[model samples]
Target: MSATGVVNVDDARVAYRLHGRGPAVVLVNGTGGGDGHWGDLIERLARSRTVVTLDYSGAGETTDNGAPLDLPTLARQVAAVSEAVAAPHVDLVGHSLGAAIATVLAAERPELVRTLTLVAGFLTAAEPRLKLTFELWRRLIAVDREGFIQILALTTLSDKFFASPLAAHLDALAQGILTGTNWEGLARQVELDLRVDIHAEASRVRCPTLVVGCAHDQIVTRARDLCDRIPDATFSEIDAGHQAYFEASEEFAAKFLTFADGLYSPRRLSSSVS
Candidate 1:
């Protein structure tokens, strides 16, 4: 079964979609992403589980008064959607910014999450490199939107991707990114990204968790740091960049499904991309 709806969260109208059936698996998107971004992964997971996706306050079909984005509020929005689903508990899969939100949720509301999977996640953006990158993003968005997207692509995608035949369609890819992006929303998310700090929450996460890192990721290089903070959390690395889910979808899905199904051993500290 498939359905779509919105959940009221403070001043925001958060949109969400449901696909397939069985155990619930909620997928949370990163900065500038929405429920729509999980199309491919949803297709793979939905075959065996009810896949849920939602747009944060500034992304996708979600809307809110122009309040500056914050981690607590964003996490609340995710919690609202999870509660709306009425599931006893759901497997939570979060990427990048979504991972931080998931960390907060898992800490504050452990009963809502059965298992947690954080991909390309980080403990905080207070690190010099991350802070500078996000600051640059804010400035670029204000002065040069096109350049901002171009730079984003360069940093998030691996060199291997650019060397592949798919590079011939770079123009189309950029155009799609340009058209699909919500500039104002993205700017707000970028602002939130700059302020993200979830170390305390990560340590409080008691649920089984998996932290997936991108070997070539230029963004969120501290994914393993997050894993170290969480008790018994397993760490895995994919041979791609920040956008590993897109660059290596099959491998990403396989790892995620294995963890979500409880087949993966938390004792295993690390796993390489197969």
Candidate 2:
């Protein structure tokens, strides 16, 4: 079973959950989502390694001062969680916005990060597609949240997923977003997404890093370039969409665990290879 707790970061109470027992691994969430989005991945990874998932300030169970979101502050929040849960260095995995924050953390607080895994994470706000998408997303959130979620689903999952019976889950997510969550927090995060540029910091990351790109991702088109900017970063592609972790959970977890084991447990790494 996972143990849940909260840590005070600045004025915010950052909520986190820890599970399993082995080398530590921290999973970060994307924009407008939290640790809850990682249920499937957590279940799989927690069996072998200690897994920590954090809810950013103003999202999930974490509480904040309701101030505008920024990369430095968000990165610090992640660092705090890592410091509290992990012994010394913890393997870090991030998706989308969480990836960006992880990059900043890996760069700024290199001592706390053992290895870094970035899934569908961009390094900067230079992508025209992302800029336009977030702009439209913010507008839709203010004017029509239901419509915003439907549109979000369009970009997150692939066409194959939409054709599957699981597509109903998107509707459920949309309904949850309509009734749950704070718009101010989301708006601040969207603004942070537009402004976050961790190129300088990401370039400084010296740890063994893996960049996972979605083959059919419609959201972030610059995953390749994002990897390129990082110093000696290894890149891999998943045959899914932006939400590949959800669309292809087994493949996603396999890729991540393979990389993680290679760094922390040579025995597990060799066993997996055999």
Candidate 3:
């Protein structure tokens, strides 16, 4: 069984759902991602733990005033949902943009986050390649929506995935992206993506951290650099593209479960959560 609710944070109505029961684990989505992106991973995790998933202001069932998005505000929204769920501490698993948000939350309120996992995360977007990519994404959405979705699919998914049988569903995938997208919200998120810099916050995160990098990720290539910045953060790699969690769900879930369960030893242990 599962329960759902909404948390009013600032000008946004953050929608969240809770599944299964055990130690709490919050899954934070990346740019343009929502509850649906979790797919089978949610079911796998929910079998032995409480999984929390939510939509940011620009995605899914969540709604917010037409204002620009910022990291602190997004992190606060996640914090609000965490508080609403009545969990004393949670294991946060964030992807791409969500990883930066999770880092901010863990740094600001270390007591609320028991562990942190960053998948395909980057420290900053000021790099020329990333900045240009997001700028192009914003512009493409305005003049060519279909082109935008097609380009997104090409960049986020691995070539290996396309060669697989799943390639037959490309049309369905594109249609889903078109209907589910909130253009205005996504544009704001893209703007946020271009300006996000969590260098300061990454150093302040005081939880057992795992940074997972994707080998063929074209979107964010600084996952290794991010892992190096955090004190004693464990680093791992997946053989997939930007959407490693979705591309290699089983492997990602196994590594996540091991880390969250405190069964894996860290390369270097700087601090411990009590």
Q: Which candidate number has the best TM-score?
A: 3
| lDDT per residue (tens digit) for residues 1-274 in model 3 | 5999999999899999999998899999998998767767898899988999999878888999979999999999999999888999899999999999999999999999989999999999997878888998989988998999888888888999899887898899889989889888888898899998999999988788999999999888889989988887999999999998888889999999878785324742543522
- As a whole number from 0 to 100, the lDDT of residue 141 in candidate 1 is 87
The CA lDDT of each predicted structure is: 0.87, 0.84, 0.89
Ranking of candidates on TM-score, top first:
3, 2, 1
TM-score of 3: 0.94
Task: For candidate 2, write residues 180-218 as lDDT tens digits.
Answer: 877778888888888978888888988778999999999
Best of the two (1, 2) by TM-score: 2
For model 1, residues 156-266, the per-residue Cα lDDT tens digits are 889998998867978886788789888899999999999898989999999889899999999788889999999889999999989888778889889888876744346
**Which 10 consecutive positions of candidate 1 have the poorest summed lDDT?**
265-274
Regions more than 4 Å wrong, model 3: 263-274
Q: Tell me the spans in candidate 1 whose CA falls farther than 4 Å from its real position.
A: 263-274
| TM-score to native of every candidate shown | 0.92, 0.94, 0.94
Query: How high a TM-score does candidate 1 get?
Result: 0.92
Worst 10 residues of 3 by lDDT: 265-274
The top-ranked prediction according to lDDT is 3
The residue pairs in collision within model 2 are none
